[model samples]
Target: MKAARIHAYGDADQIRVEDAPIPAIGPDDVLIRTVAASVNPVDWKIRRGYLEKMLPYDMPLTLGWDVSGIVEAIGADVTTFKPGDAVYSRPDIRRNGTYAEYVAVRAREVALKPTTISHVEAASLPLVSITAWEALITTAGLQPGQRVLIHAGAGGVGSIAIQLAKAKGAHVTATASQGKTALVRSLGADEVVDYHNPTAFAAARDMDIVFDTIGGDTQDASWAMLKPGGFLVSITAPPSAERALAEGKRVGFVFIDPNAAILRDLAQLVDGGKIRPLIGGEFRLDDAAKAQLASETGRTTGKIVIYTGQP
Candidate 1:
């Protein structure tokens, strides 16, 4: 099998495409012939050694979590999937990932790909959709008729978060550049704030929830916009406990734990035409390094996918 891996944690230069043995599966795993994989910020962060302390891994690691492909083989105990089944997953981050010709994923974390979208599109959803789901539904508990603010509305996570929140009948407001206002609104944001404007979020106060995909200054400013009991959910960094307490609000941080049930529900939404995968770019498998560099720019409006050339 051909895989893109890093022998050491460093820059994009460290990523190399080379020959590797096809991974063997556990009794509960399924071997997928990779059709596509998507790049996330976490991939570049891990490659740059920024997450070494938090997510320590041995050298020569494959660095993608999102995958969409065909099941080429299955292990003894894997009954939900079989050879030739189309599937997608945000695989466990502790093991080898989907940046290869094939990936071995636990059957429990895998879900059928939505029939409405292509493999590249399916590959883009797992990580970002799961992150958004965990942040909005699990952590913030967003409800119908509630107002919620999502930063980076045009981003991979924020784009989906906006749609999911709207699907649940929440009044969604998202922050993005003026150029992307139409894009965010099309994704179901009731209001779009021009992030370049210093007072962008000033009028968006008293929200029921705030899903922060961009931390630092944007997060700090969001505290004032929430209602007394509103929830502040973050995927980039942990919200300040002191600030939340003093402001009479709730704070939660999300580390995406892939769940098959949640993925199934998300698939329902996708298949029902309630949500769509946004693809910003696509690259061949061997261009993984370039893809990582592009993600590091933080300018993409949606997910960057790597097509693995599987039939």
Candidate 2:
């Protein structure tokens, strides 16, 4: 099988597509013939060795976790899916990843691909959608009729978060560049703030939740926007516990724990037309490095998908 791997972390240039042995599965895992995968910021971050302390991945790592593929074989204990089943997952990031012709993923992490979308679109959903679902629904416990603000509303996680929040009947506000406001609004954001305009979000106060995908100054600014006791969940970095205490707000950092149950629910939402993927670009598996570069630009309106050139 051909896989895109980095023997040593550095830049996108370090990625090479080359022949590698197909991974064997464990008793609780399934072997998937990769159809498509998507590039997230974490892909490039891992390539740059930014997550070494936390992940400690072995060298020659295949650098993709978001996958939509067909099951080629299943482990003896895996009963939920069978050979030839179409599946999607944000597979555990500790293993060799999906940027290859074949990948082995834990059966507990896999879900049937949403029937309403294509493989490329399904490939785009798992990671970002799971992150959003975990942040808003699981951690924040967002309620209907509440107001919430999502940063980077046109980016991968933010785009899905907006739709999910709206599906939960929340009043959604989002931040995007001036150029992408319309796209953000189309994703069900009730109000779109131009992020380039520093004062644009001043009026966005008394929110029940603030989903922060961008850290640093953006996270700093979001604190004042939330009402007292409201939640602020960040995927980028952990917010200050002391500050949250001082301000009488709740704060948490979300590191996605892949859940097949959430993926199942997200698929139902996708099929029910309550959510849809926003794809910014597509690349062949051989161009995995190029896909990472595009994600590194941090300007894509949605997810960047990579096709493995398989059926």
Candidate 3:
């Protein structure tokens, strides 16, 4: 098999496509024939050694996290899936990832791919969807009939977060470029603030939750948009301890985990037409470097997919 792997953490130039051995599965795992994967900012972060201390990976690592494919084989203890089943998963970040032509993922981390979408589309959802789920649903305890603000609404996590919040009956407010106002609104955001305008969200106070995907200034600005006692959840970095203490708010930083139950629920929402995956671009497996570059730029509208083309 050919995999895009890095011998040492550095830049995009470090990623090289080369021959590699097929992975052996444990009794609780399933071996998937790769069809497609998606690029995320964390992929590049890990590649450049930013997460080395936290993730503690061995050298010569494959760096993708999202996958949509067909099950080629299942291990002895795996009964939830079978040979020839279509599945998708945000595989455990500790293992060899989904960048190659094959990935062995724990059966509990895999779910049947939504039947309504293509492999490329299914590949786009896992990581981002899981991030949103952990942030709003698991961490913040967002409820219906409330208000939620999503930063970078056209982004991977934000786009899906807007729709999921709306599906739960929350009034969704999102920030995006002027050009993406319609796009975000179409995705169920009740209001779309112009991200380029510093004061565009000044009137967005009294929210039940704020989901921040953009850090730095954007995150700083989001602090003023929540009412007292509202929750603030971020996937980019940890919330400001000082600000949370002064503002009487609950702040949390979400490190996403793989849960088959969340993926199954998302699949139902997708197949029922209540939500959908947003695919911004596609690249071949050999072009993993290029895809990672695009994600690093922080300008992609949604998920950028990598097609492995393996049967």
lDDT of each: 0.91, 0.94, 0.91
- Please write out the lDDT profile of model 3 over residues 9-107, one tens digit for every residue: 998999998888989999999999989999998999999999888899987898899999999999999989999999999999999999899999999
For candidate 3, report its TM-score. 0.97
Which 10-residue span in candidate 1 carries the lowest summed lDDT? 195-204
lDDT of 2 by residue, 128-245 (tens): 9999999999999989999999999999999999999999999999999889988899999999998778677787789999999999998999999999999999999999999999
Tell how far residue 220 is off in model 1, in angstroms. Answer: 0.4
Comparison by lDDT, 2 against 3, better one: 2
Error of 2 at 199 (Å): 2.4
- The per-residue C-alpha lDDT of model 3 at residue 59 equals 76
> Over the stretch 37-118, how does candidate 1's per-residue lDDT look in tens digits?
9999999888899988888898789879999999999999989998989999999998988999999999999999988899
- Candidate 3 ranges beyond 4 A from true positions: none
Query: How do all models score by TM-score?
Result: 0.98, 0.98, 0.97
- Which ranking of candidates, highest TM-score first? 2, 1, 3
**Higher-lDDT candidate of 1 and 3:** 1
Candidates in descending lDDT order: 2, 1, 3
